[model samples]
Target: MSSDFQNVVPDTEHKGLVGLLPAVARPFAVLARFDRPIGWWLLFWPCAWGIALAGGAIDRWDLLLWLLLGAIAMRSAGCVYNDIVDRDLDRQVERTRSRPLASGAVSLKAAWIWLAILCLIGLIVWLQINGVAKLVALGSLALVAAYPFMKRITWWPQAWLGLVFSWGALVGWLAIVPEFHWAMALLYLGSIFWVIGYDTIYALQDREDDALVGIRSSALRLGDNVHFGVLNFYLMALSSWAAAFWMLRPHWLAIVTLAPISLHLLWQVTTLKSADGDDALAKFRSNRFAGLLMFLACLVLGQAG
Candidate 1:
């Protein structure tokens, strides 16, 4: 592989398809972050949680599959769009300086084209759902499109991301039930805090660089108190999720189902090394497992008679 293809940040250690693809195709793969399956997994989990909690997963597994596909495609599309919009800022940040668009390995036109292709795939996934779900899914586009600029304007871009990333919860619930419920709303809200918590962990990797570049983030905003902030966010997430579970099943067991994830979040907070970039990345990636724990909690609660 050429040096250009070798420029991916250290955080995404596994090159996967990017490693196997011809050098000419490597930049596009990086742009879509196919090498980083964690992004898609984080995005997919909220969709899965929504489906399971809404009682759709047992009978409508196909819908869960479609939402997963949508998450991968749309997450890729969002990354491409973010790269395009933040190329200048990315060039200034150490971790992002080597991104395809930032490093000039991929041109603006090509990046946009790749984004379009991903969006087209997302559209195909969107078409698989009902009209109301389609509408709910479409509602996320504005949030997605605005996200690249949030770091430029706010200290809490992660909050905006919380809204964007957790949207699948809403879409997943609506895809099956068609009507809104307070439980779904609570699930969505809790997922938002979960995203905020995890993404703050992710932002810790770029804290110094982002500060130097005048970019705002929760990690930077919390400064020395980042770990405390994360703990608070995680606690809020668990509280909200517990409330949602109780609303759904109204049983002690439903709350107990959340114990595993609560412990997992506790482990993440306790083990986190805030100033260590590699540790931050590992903790951020661990949320994939956190998502699974939540899904099981939702599954158990949703399945109860």
Candidate 2:
């Protein structure tokens, strides 16, 4: 939850269970991003997209639970590792200065330990998945480990994030189907572009800080043309989703039913004010709803079939 971005200073105002908890409990929460659940939601949506779109029936309640838990654990673990690696850079940025690692509330050693704990939880969840899905999930570790360094090396770090964040889409589909399908592959690609679009919007919030810190981001890459770039990415996202849908269900009505989600993405692009960091962040966060809308459309199409 980048909401901490708004309050650079820790809110020492209300000190209760969170503040009074043992020293051990405090850093773990920060490591897990208990203060910010949105990251988990963003991570969870792609899994939902893969599962619901496969039309393989959602009777596997156990698998759904595993995916849900895995999303939370892995997202938290990713954030902890990212913060640990970026602590120096984070200290230079106002929005990130107060982060546990950056602010020295948690030591680097402690952060790594917490990261291990979260990853252990993730591994436990991964073991609950099928062999194919488990292998697919394990394969994402390299991407996740290298993501923090991508901003330093590439102008399009969001594209790298697209790969990291949307890996669950593949795992989700594999958990159900256990075999490759062109339709699911297209849907995974669509989710990647969706992550790139929204994460670009998120990066817009840090453009100034990132520039000063010598960090690269799609927002900096696109600059004044970020809005147009976002439009293009979101448009491509919709097109890929539409292609995925039509490939699975060739009916004209399926494409028609996708209209609402497509219109929503259009609204996101048309009304987006990239110059306003708050507006851009709000729009970025709104993708949770966009994801849900798309999932509902998938549900309808899957059920209708």
lDDT of 1 by residue, 236-256 (tens): 999999899888888788889
| TM-score, every prediction | 0.98, 0.92
What TM-score, to 2 decimals, does candidate 1 have?
0.98
Query: Relative to the unseen true structure, what is the Cα RMSD of model 2?
Result: 3.2
lDDT for model 2, on a 0 to 1 scale?
A: 0.82
Cα lDDT for residue 279, model 1?
91
Model 2, residue 245: distance off in Å is 0.8
Q: Residue 79's C-alpha lDDT in candidate 1?
A: 93
In angstroms, the error of model 2 at 31 is 3.2
| Per-residue lDDT value at 77 in model 1 | 93
Angstrom error at residue 112, model 2: 1.2
Which residue pairs show backbone clashes in model 2? none
